[model samples]
Target: MRIVDVCAFYTPHGGGVRTYVEQKLRIGPQLGHEIVILAPGDEDGVVERGPNARIVTLKSPRFPLDRKYGYFASAEQLHGALDALAPDFVEATSPWRSAGLVADWAGAAPRSLVMHADPLSAFAYRWFGQVFSRRTIDWQFSVYWEHLRRHSRRFDHVVCANSDLSRRLAEGGVPRTVTLPMGVEPGRFSPLNRDPALRARLLAACDLPESASLLLGCGRLSPEKRWPMVIDAVNAAGQQSPIGLVMFGEGRERRTILKHIAGNPHVRLFEPERDRETFARILASPDGLIHGCEAETYCMAAAEARASGTPVIVPDGGGAADHAGDGAGMTYAACDPAAAARAIATVLRSPRRQPQEARTITQHFAELFALYEDTRARVRMAA
Candidate 1:
């Protein structure tokens, strides 16, 4: 089978989207498939991956707000490539204007819209939460929901990373919305890699002893991440007992997040870890993963923390909450610092839970390809 993915978020320095696409390309050939990625780049070029995979880049202008990424503007170039490649299956992984570019293409290939993020929850709600209520925001964004429903109705399937997103889209009348949870890299993180010395050193960095509790906050430090609330919760919890938060991430909101963490000695933000082995050790070393974001489509960092045998403290709602309470996890009401602080203290005092089985990215691709194959067959039969 031959499949093509039209993705605009696959940038050189992108986060989750880039990681997911790279893993799919790596595993496509092993599943007896040829995979092609049609993406916007600095120039038109092609990079051949092992044998059955390649990336076709088209010259494009920088995206608004973030210059690190680009958008698809030349419909002719994108459609021309799809015409030439003639893939059996196609996927548009971004919900931006580029998605319409893919949807407009006259390819006979059955297509899917695999969501990269939940704009309504991640952006709209976070941007206006301080000023408006949830019902008011939903009413204001009714046009956007209708827009999504209109476009997604054309695709064979609307793939979501979590049930919350799938349910929302389905409720908004998007036909064939399917939930397929993403998977973690196998052997990349484990409780066995937990280092006592590293934990002690991290605690000491915050002027605390080995007995101090350490919490890990891993994600892009954007406005939507709600890092300020996490910092406040940690500070409040630290007042009662020795506690420190080590956040690992780098993003456009670094300065803002740093400002929010200012005057708080127990919370520190660090650059994203590059080496997988080193990051795995650091992840497993933390006592618990404390997160404040309540609008994630699927929180991979929380999954990694649980897979590492570390307890978790997440908001009461969102994708991350789905994995809570399975082992050593606790959920507090969203946007409540006092509740978060109490939850943190409870998790620290609770008995340690053994690491649960982590799903592998390879398995994810295998299942995804099977679904693509089935969709292709169904589309051909209908034609």
Candidate 2:
């Protein structure tokens, strides 16, 4: 079976969606399927091709609305590409302009749309007022949601990354909404592969002493991620433990966060690690991962951290709770810095029970890949 993944952004440009597509492409061939990715061109250049999958670049001019490193592709160009590929199945990550082209190319083949984030999540930054005004954010979300509601109807299957997204789709009257948790590459993230020297070097480079308990928060440094909360939690926790906070990822909120932590000696921010190896190294070295984001389809960083035998301390609500798993980590009420701080401290002082269990429980990704294989088989039968 041949599967074409349509998304407005791809690897080296996008986040979880990009990684998810790339993982599918890597593993699909082993399950007897070919995968192709279609995404917009960025300053970084077109995606580098690989054996299991080929990346097709669709050029689009940069615009103001393309704020979050996302771009809109021309429908005509996308249709031409799909018509040429004639894939057995089409999987779209977003129901944006690119998704419209996928809908247009629906010909007899089965198509699926994977919803990684709720359209309303884009509006989450409005409250912070550092990125976009409330009015502008509202308008952006309204437009995106309206497009998703209409275009999503055309897909044979619609997958939501979590139950919240599934509920949102259900409310919008979308048919065939299935909740599929995102999977992590355990091979890359396992604790057994941790490089202690690399971890020590990263800590030293970040000006953190080996004795300091490091708390990591990995994700786009955006207002929605609520990074300030993590900083505050670390500050509060510093009273108890010698805590150093290191955050990975770059975004519009970098300057704001930098300014917020100007006088704080305990916090350090670094550019997002593009290489998976570096990311896994940081995950394994961190004492615990902190996540304050109110909305997350699936907390890829938290999952990776847990998979690396690092406990995750996430907020109570959101998709992350589902991924944290029972006994894998601690989940506190949203934005409670004290709770977040306490959770981190507790995890650091406690025995290695949770991290050990995390390694055992996170093998669910194998089950998820089985589902992906099954989906491909069904598509082949229909084809």
Candidate 3:
């Protein structure tokens, strides 16, 4: 089958969505499918060419907030690209402008709407947290809900990477919602990858001795990620014993995170590790991975942490909690810094979970590919 993914959130310097798309490109061919991606770029043309997979860049304008990202302007160009690809199936991976365009597509192949992020919790709560109650913010988010609810009807399937988002969309009246968890490369990140030297260096960077409990935080340093809350929790936990935190990742919250961790020798912010093996070793070395986001869809960071045999500390809701798994880590009340601190202390006091082998990426690929086939078959039968 030939599958085309229209992703507005993919860029050379983007986050999880970019990684997900790239991973799909690598796996699609192994599953005997051709995968093409249509993404926004400064230059309009095919940048990556391969027999089974390729990325087609559509000329678009730079996003004002961050020039690293591009915004789609002409829907006609997108439609033209889709028409040319003539894929067996189409998947719209973002809820922004591209989604509406893909939903209204009058094409031969079936379409699927992949919900990669939650707009209400990721954006609204982060944007209006100071001005309105969550209930009020959620009420305002209904506008977005209605937008998706209407567009989702046009697609053959609505797919979510976690059950939380799937249940929310299903409850909100979106049809054919499905939960499909993403997978991690267990070989890249395992307990055996743990490096005592790297752990020592990380501890030293945070100005802590080897005796101090080292907590690792990974992901975008954005407001929705709630890194500040994690920093506060670490500081609170520091009062009890020697605890240090090293956060990896960059985002709009860099300055804010720096300010939050200022004057605390035990907390430091570091740029994301580019080397995969080194990063996995870092994950394996940490006493635990602490996550603050409650609106997470499928936290690849937490999943990778678990794959590295590192225990995770996450909020009690959202995808992170689901990835933490029973006996894999600890969970605190959602968005509660105090509770998170206690959870951190508990994890440090308790013996670490024995590193277990993680399911391979092939498993996730097979499951998602089956969904595509099933959707296509159902569409043909209905036709």
Candidate with more favorable, higher TM-score: 1 or 2 = 1
Per-model CA lDDT versus the true structure? 0.86, 0.71, 0.86
Clashing residue pairs in candidate 3 (N, C-alpha, C atoms within 3 angstroms): none
Query: What is the TM-score ranking, best to worst?
Result: 1, 3, 2
> Against the true structure, candidate 3 has what lDDT?
0.86
Residues 1-383 of candidate 1 have per-residue lDDT tens digits of: 99999988898786888888888889889899999998899999999988999999999999878898998888898899899889999999988787788889998999999987888888888788779997799889988877787888788889888887888788777789988888788878789989999999888877678988999999997887888899989989988888989999988789988888885777778888889898888888988999998888778888888878888899877788866867659999988999999999999989888866887778878888899999888888898
Q: Candidate 2 lDDT, tens digit per residue, 1-383? A: 67778767564566776677767766766656677777666542345456657777666666465554446556676677778878877778776666677787846667888776664654454354467774566555666657776787887678766776687667666777877676577567877756767665656755667887777888987777889888888888889868778888887888999988886766778888878787778788777888888688778788778878887888776677765565778888776788888888887886654455333213433444455557767867877
TM-score of every model versus the real structure? 0.96, 0.81, 0.95
* Winner by lDDT between candidate 2 and candidate 1: 1
Candidate 1 TM-score over all chains jointly: 0.96
Better of 1 and 3 by TM-score: 1
- lDDT per residue for candidate 3 within 253-367, as digits (tens), equals 8998888887787887888999887888898998999999988998988999988888899988778988777688999987789999999999899897785668666788788
In model 2, the runs with Cα more than 4 Å from the true position are 42-52, 67-73, 124-146, 193-212, 274-278, 354-383
